[model samples]
Target: MIYVNEAADPRLDDFRDLTTADRRPDRPGGRGLVIAEGTVVVRRLLASPYRPLAVLGVRRRVEELADDLAELTVPAYVTSSEVMAAVVGFHLNRGVLAVADRVPPPTVESVVADARVLAVLEGVGDHENLGSLFRNAAAFGVDGVLLGPGCADPLYRRSVRVSMGNVLRVPFTALPDWPRALLGLRRRGFTVAALTPRPDAVDLRRLPDGATGRVAVLLGSEGHGLSEQAIAAAELAVRIPMAPGVDSLNVATAAAVAFYELTALAHPGHPAIATPRPRQRTDGGTVGQ
Candidate 1:
């Protein structure tokens, strides 16, 4: 609960300018600290395993976190928003920031060890999309995320903000060996479904029963869709039905829909996504596998 009034205070260095925030990546340490902006995200950072080094904010913003900060071991640097912006090199409308070292990402095997429904992503380099995907996954009760390739760092400041800090709670991992890693998932009883817009793909509602054990939805970036190697590695190419000529949904939105369908089956009692209500397919038959 220490109130810091000076920007020159040595205790505030960890919360310094964003211009060089990423610069530390080239330093001997070779990595930048995790930064959480806004009160919501900052509160999440404080709760995460990553040890909070310091908190910087205007008085009011820091006060919002007083409940969490009561027994916090870190210092809270309070300042005017103008002074805060001058030190941080931009006018951060969030009015607060917290810095913490990153925790290690989980191993792919561990992330999927007990996963009933997981989301594996490829070429998802946009931070906001990545964050939104995590939030959607959490809302739909997805178990985890496995990064296939070209995925952005989920702990990046913008990702943390956009996720509303859900990134701090959802566990994720980097799956090595590219598409080859998908084999390892299958070995553990996961039926990997690559979501794509290709018409020849099986309609989501008509997916096979093999998806029961441990299901994983393989996702791709919105721009180009899944890579050939990804599609080739999957057990099924699944497509969500949309009106003709409607193209597809946002990557995160698509994840939400697929997660809702898959996870509802995996965990029957989960309430947010109720049991699927039978609906007609475009061909005029009862839906759901």
Candidate 2:
């Protein structure tokens, strides 16, 4: 590790003033670097496909990554916490940061080619929600994530930290054609199910369990949910049964529930499936009181 006491060291430019550094290159004033914070995330970044640029951290934190850095030729700049805080533009309690150049995401066709279940997102622009959704997707063995329009870049620094770096592991790509691209998935034998709160939708738990065939769960933004055009493109609509007067769930939380349900239905032996939910009637009442 190279020791540096100066915050203005020319080599440390990649980590300077990070608040706006996470923007995509297409956005104004963006470098499009994938930044991983803390040891856990930094380690995952190192293992990810993105090429490592450099690492900036305190000496202790840098030493902790010795094994990971042993074979890597990139520079690891070790410095005091004060210097790190100044360079990073904020006092980072995690004390370690790693930066990498963004790589091209896999093609949607490639991601869908070998997947049993996938998470298809639309208008989920919140970084934390996107990150949490990915973490849930990884937790439930989701094969991949397909980004529809109005989605945020999952590689943003906040997203990377929030996802515990699972974004780096999850294969995702943009579907620039919006709802039209969903037709391609349907043609490929995927049952595109849009998750919505409409009264006419099928109850999520009521769907057949231990089912066969590929499924894609379409999710929408927290504010407005899925667009009508997008929902119309789906093969079916499903909803999680909730208490009366409750409208919906946070998109990521709703996704976790949906992912778990799908996984349980497809693979009954999966350990994370919860206890069976009570059956509900078509009129929104409990069955066989």
Candidate 3:
């Protein structure tokens, strides 16, 4: 590991000016490089599929990640906090920073094959919401995430930090199949439940009755909720009962509540084994592109 005292070191370009460096390429003044701040996230990124370009930090922070950095063939630029802040444009309390190219996730079918409860997202462009969904999914025993249509990348720097690096731990796949692709899940005996606030829809608590096989929960963007196509494709639509009219919880918060209810419904021990849930049909074909 080669170390440098100057923040101007040419080898350290990847970790420079992180505050605005992570913006999308399409956005004005954006480089779109995948960035990871803090020791934990940087370490995960190094371990992830994305190849590490370089790392920059103060001496203490770099030393703290010595174990993680041991296998890397990249440069480790060590400098004073003053220099680091100046070069990065903003003071990063996390101390360490690593940058790498974005590595896309796998396709839909492989991600769903061995999963139980999967979270399918559509039009969830909010990074924080997406990250929180992955964190909640991991906490409640959900296996993987399927980016149905418009979900943002879970590997984005902010998402990684918000998820506390759980995004690296949980696998995610992008599904190009819109509503039509859900047919593949049906073939796998998955009862697709779209989480909505519709009154006529089945109650969220009423699920898991005979759900012995796989299941997928479809969620939509924060602004407009699920698309009509997504809702119509699912076997049933369910919603959480709130006090009178509490508008609705944030997408991630709503997901947490739904997860809690779903998990309880699935593992309700002795007294709840006999509850009757909507019948699950193993219908449809393999997911097509």
Candidate 4:
């Protein structure tokens, strides 16, 4: 561990002025760095395929990650909280931060090759909503995510933080040619089911038996929903039933509901959707399994 007394130290450049545009990897003049905040997210970054360049935190937070750091040869910068705040351009309550270079993303074919359930997104420009969708995908065991078009970069800093770092865990790839690209998924035996709120759409709970086979749930931005062409390209359209006054749900919430339903359908008896077994006493002990 290196104790740096000055915030101006050259080694701390990767973490300097994080809020500025130049540090935003998704924008022009950006370094394209993958940053992880807090001990939990930092630990996840360390475990991810991305190679850690450096770690900066106060002494206590640094000590908390001692074991994770021990396995790495990267520099761990231990500094005072005041210095850390000054270096990062804000008071980061998470205390610890790690930055790594972005790695090449997997191709659509690779991510879909062996997947059973997938989440396909279009025009989901909001980073927070995209992040929450990724978190939900991870929660429900979604095999992968396919970005159809106009989706935000899942590795953006806000997305990484909002997702509680699940973005690092879930595999994702970009789909080419917009709605037309969906045909590739179909050829691979995936039934592309688009989620929409149209009255004529099939109820989400009553999905056809064929939907239980390798399925891809196509979701769109909440404001406009899926484009007509996108919906028409899908094998079927499904909707979550709501009250008369409610017309739609936030994109992330809607994605979560769809993911749960589709994943449960695809993998019956999964822990998340399975009914809990009643406990009964056996000859030697209580049993539930």
How well does model 2 score by local distance difference test?
A: 0.88
Candidate 3 clashing pairs, residues 3+ apart or interchain:
none
Error of 1 at 24 (Å): 1.8
Each model's lDDT comes to 0.85, 0.88, 0.78, 0.88
Weakest ten-residue segment in model 1 by summed lDDT: 22-31
Q: If candidate 1 were superposed on the true structure by all CA atoms, what would the RMSD be?
A: 3.0
Candidate 4 Cα lDDT to native: 0.88
Top-down TM-score ranking? 4, 1, 2, 3
Candidate 1 lDDT over residue span 23-77, tens digit each: 5755445656888899988898899888898888999999999999888888888
Candidate 3: give its CA RMSD in angstroms.
8.1
C-alpha TM-score for every candidate: 0.90, 0.90, 0.83, 0.91
Writing each residue's lDDT as its tens digit, candidate 3 over 1-289 gives: 4567777776776666666566666643454666778888888878887787888888888898898888778777878888888788888898888877766567676788787778889998988998898889777767788887878878776787888777876779888768888877878888888999888877776665655456788999878999999999998898888788678789998888877666545444424322333455568433332
Q: Which stretches of candidate 2 lie over 4 Å from their true place?
A: 24-31, 208-211, 268-289
- RMSD (CA, Å), each prediction: 3.0, 4.4, 8.1, 5.1
Please provide, for model 2 over 135-247, each residue's C-alpha lDDT reduced to its tens digit, 9 standing for 90 to 100. Answer: 99988888899999999989888888899999999899998788998888899888888999988898886764323368899999989999999999998899989898996
Best by TM-score: 4
Q: Write the per-residue lDDT of candidate 4 for residues 1-289, one digit (tens) a residue.
A: 9999999999998888877623565644464588899999999999998899999999999999999999799899999999999998999999999998788889887899889899999999998999999999998889999997889988888899998898999999888898898887888889899999999999998888889879999999988999999998899999999888886999889888998788877777677663434555766565766
